[model samples]
Target: MTFRKLMIAGAAVALLAVGATAAMAQTSAQKALIDAAKSQGTVGEQADGYVGVRTNADAELRAAVDATNNGRRAVYARSATEAGTTTEIAAARMFETQLLARVSSGQWYRNAAGQWVQR
Candidate 1:
């Protein structure tokens, strides 16, 4: 193949690989943090398409929440772009229709009014 063509193909491959990595499921550490946070009522899903602290948390827990929520925001931003909607609308729709179902009873979550409540 021509060098220019080869470069293009290589770029495409790299892009696809990055996309695949992004599509992979969350890491074990991430899962564990989220689980612990939920159980402890330290973090929970919010109506804004991201997770947040339901109550005060230690530094480690706070960091985990921040990481997870940041990841969620990136996803929400992409979904919003694809759906031609605002990020807040996209997040609210996901929280109301899908994310809430994953939350366990007694877990803390932010309701539509942004108030924290136990699920």
Candidate 2:
């Protein structure tokens, strides 16, 4: 792999390790809501390292998305600072490596081009 690819891969592995701990920061209820929304195709991972609502979202779903994105922003900010990179780059990397890879079959995710596609 190219040096850039290698760096990203390494960072991805690091992020994955960090993710397990970070996930514990979220409540079980929050994770359940997001997972349910994802499974139902109402919410999806976005290229910006945030969750997007793909269809009409109820108040509860919207709140859950907002909470999840807020947590993601904090993680990306910390990761960027540690890596000496911008938050956007850190988030994009996480999206490419972590979020995309986590998408279950038949779930939806928004691509870098802002298009929603099902896996």
For candidate 2, lDDT tens digit of each residue in 1-119? 87656655566566666667667787788899999999999999999888999999999889888887777777777776666667788889999877899999999999999999999
lDDT of 1 at 27: 64
lDDT of 1 by residue, 34-53 (tens): 79889988888887757888
C-alpha displacement of 59 in model 2, angstroms?
Answer: 1.3
* Predicted structure 1, TM vs. truth: 0.74
Evaluate model 2: give its TM-score: 0.87
Candidate 1 yields a Cα-based lDDT of 0.68
Model 2, position 111, has a per-residue lDDT of 97
Question: Clash number for every model?
Answer: 0, 0
TM-score of each: 0.74, 0.87
